[model samples]
Target: MDKLKKNEKWFWGGVVLIELILFYSSSMTYKQQTSVPFLEKYVHGKPLKSSLSQIHFNYGGKEQSIANDGYYHFVEFFIRKGAHFGTYLILAVFLCLALYTYFKKNHFLNVFVPWLMTTGLAAFDEFHQGLTGGRTPSVTDVILDSAGALTGALIVVIITYFVIRHKNVKKV
Candidate 1:
């Protein structure tokens, strides 16, 4: 009974964490009409500057820089494009983890289940946008979101396989 209670707490805690992540990234998203200079240009494509990019994502060394505004706008575009998708991705991960932990089992279903949860998460995420100030949902975004969920699941499958293999090797 105590273990069950502890499991429930952890499960809910993971869901709460997903909500928090969604809230944060969604908040980071710049609305189309906002006064923020770069983001405004990024959304509407007013052709602000040929050289000026909105996002300055620093990959690593100072030498590597992407100055093309298209890439910046693309990044911004994905942020808007991916809001719902991010929700799906995160929820799927948590659900998969919780199920794996609970059954104390793992398999192909570990990957399958997260994608399943993603379906509901994708819907809720879009619905959330309807309630928010300047956000509108898109079907394309949901597609992208589902893509992200699948991608995450694939990664988990790879990692889980390796982990299980290592465990077996250790037992030998």
Candidate 2:
């Protein structure tokens, strides 16, 4: 049993390490971080050029071209926010798992601790981005990341509740 627990710890630790790698890689230059490569070729007229190109927009009965037009910016915004949400989501999930595995009780602690830790990590990530070239830190991103983490943690909590309820039913 101890060996199994140890292995689980290592596995979740690896998941966390991968999330760190993703967070760090995301802090690199804009060109270094490419999201949705498959959509790039089809949407941008070429590969590696989704957020880097100017797009056309129709606004208030007038047509205009902007670096980040309505459609393009919308897509780019989603991509960036999705990345933030996903990375933090994974982090929170693994964190909650690890904490719960270790403690095995205290539901509130298991949930809130992971949320707080993930939120702090998100803030640190933005601070790290500020130190990198071509990257600027934004509090809004931190908020987005926190929301993502909270969502991930909530999902785990819900699943755990169901699993425990099912087990209790079986016992009854």
Candidate achieving the largest TM-score = 2
lDDT of 2 by residue, 1-172 (tens): 2443566776478557956786777579766775445444568644334553455554334444435344444465557778888988888888877766764566777678889988998898788888889987878788888998898888878888788789789999
Candidate 2: C-alpha lDDT = 0.72
Model 1 per-residue lDDT tens digits across residues 22-101: 66554443454333456656556544444544345432222222353344554554454455456566666666555665
- Residue 80, model 1: Cα distance from true site in angstroms: 3.7
TM-score of each: 0.60, 0.74
Candidate 1: regions farther than 4 A off = 1-12, 21-75, 82-88, 102-106
Residue 15 CA displacement from its true place in model 2, Å: 4.0
Candidate 2 similarity to native, TM-score: 0.74
In model 2, the runs with Cα more than 4 Å from the true position are 1-7, 34-40, 44-70
